[model samples]
Target: MSRIPEIVFVTREEIIDELWNKGIESAFNSNIYAYTWYLDIVSPGWSALITDNYDYLFPLPTKKKYGINYIIQPLYCQQLGLYSSKHITPELVDTFIDNIPSKFKYVNINLNIHNKTDKHKSDTNSRVTYMLDLLNYDDQIFPKYKENTKRNILKAFAKNHTITTSLTPSEFISFYKYNGHIESPAKEIKIIKQLIECLIRQQKLTLLGCINQSNEIGSVALFAENNDTIYYLLGARNKRIKSSSLHFLLDYQIKNRSGLGKTLDFEGSMIPSIAHFFSGFGAKPCKYLNYTKNSIPASDLILRLKKELGL
Candidate 1:
């Protein structure tokens, strides 16, 4: 809900390059900016996209820029499956908007507003992220945790298993295998390798791992660092180490990076179990904006019709 700082307004190319370099963990990067930003071009109108990602800032016509009450702005939200970072607050939003509409405006932020039944529940609120503050990852707090979670972590550590602090040949292989279960498998393994290669050469790669004696147990990769926060990119645990050791591993890493930030985000988890795991770490749930907009009324109607037709 807070406005992110260090707002850098850069061109689209720069944003992509920066994201590619830093491996920014955002779905909004490609869909919203790279693709949707072009909307203003094809369909010219007075619209502006403000973001705090520091990279994808579009320099729009300042003269044409008038922040209409969001209600009447006729602006659309992008519906990228990724979480949208919030750069504007009610205050900032107010600043952007100049002409105050005289009429009372009734707008709602209810998630799943358009969908009903199970369909809405599936992706009910697509714009929230779960952030874990590293300070929340304390050794003293671990003992007071759940019994099952506590037992597994200890079991894995006691298994005399191989745990590698840094991902090695074995860990890399396991990480990918585990990720295959996700709905959107990240770019092909080859692409990820290439991306990581580019990241490391540029020193943008922030990789961490935990292994049993020699067996790889858990690992995560991230980029971007300020004095107060660490943005998580990719993290996974070895099913073998499904033991609480993964918790210990992540906890160790969170503490390991406390210098860079007050907390470590496990990133947003769509699955309740995973979300619950992050919550167990005493992490705060954060809400960001995920938008989906359509063309003019006619065009938008057509799009909706197409969806129903498909059904």
Candidate 2:
């Protein structure tokens, strides 16, 4: 049995080895986004809250804006919250929320799917992601795909578009920059490049691409492996192409990885169209919460009073 939970805030540099060991060895929430090296690339200087027994961990990615400290969820980090090998009760979640340092006057963070609490309903917003269980063989899984998804896959095949895994980090970055519809800032793109390099070094990256008959790269995707799950970290495709290369690419992954007891996490889109695209592959929606709080009343009053007093 573990000791009574005593949560403590830890700085980024203070508990690196211990925290990462626990993260890999014991944490029940198996998300790559929570790992030390992954967090370092996307959310540098991030800290955490941990229980005395190291049974629970919560990453606090903070930022200071306009001289006020606040917590903001980092880019490419889909879900992060209480991670534990033990059962996470509502009360435990509340305890962690309550312990967030008061100096952070504002908070905006996303909790993992395993967490649930009624205590802070007013302060939380709902978010959804899609996940596909790949325990069944491809033949068994194919029947469950939406008809449209199947049609797209067939269409790509008929067009002679081939799936390829011979993509480099630099090639994928360039493709994404020019063809992707999403607005990725230069800094975020740079971080993505660095992350790809790191993942490649660890041999944990699955880079896939769809090539057209003309031998042009039309679509590309990057998936990161952590244990048995694969995260669909990022992807980009040419909109001008008539063929659905993304459909072909993801179907290729599902086919090869099926019956392997693995999961594919489509690191998500709340937009209906995008969500539908993911669901087409028979992926199901998983819900999580985003917590937000503002102690603006008290802080604003204090500021005004100080300003009026001229010191």
**lDDT tens digits, residues 1-311, model 2?**
33349999998887666656565457777688888888888888888898766668888998775556789899889998888888887778888999999999889999999888779988999999999999675566788999999999999999899988888788888888787655666887888888998898868998999999889887999999888889999988787776788999999999989898899999877999999999999999999999999874676767866776777
Runs with alpha carbons beyond 4 Å of true place in candidate 2: 1-4, 181-184, 297-311
Best by lDDT: 2
lDDT of each: 0.42, 0.85
List model 1 lDDT by residue over 135-224, tens digit each.
Answer: 434553454456665665667667764434456534563575574344434434444455456445545456666556655445444343
Candidate 2: deviation at residue 235, Å?
1.0
The collision pairs in model 2 are none
Q: Residue 290's C-alpha lDDT in candidate 2?
A: 95
Predicted structure 1, TM vs. truth = 0.53
Enumerate clash totals for all models, in the order shown. Answer: 25, 0
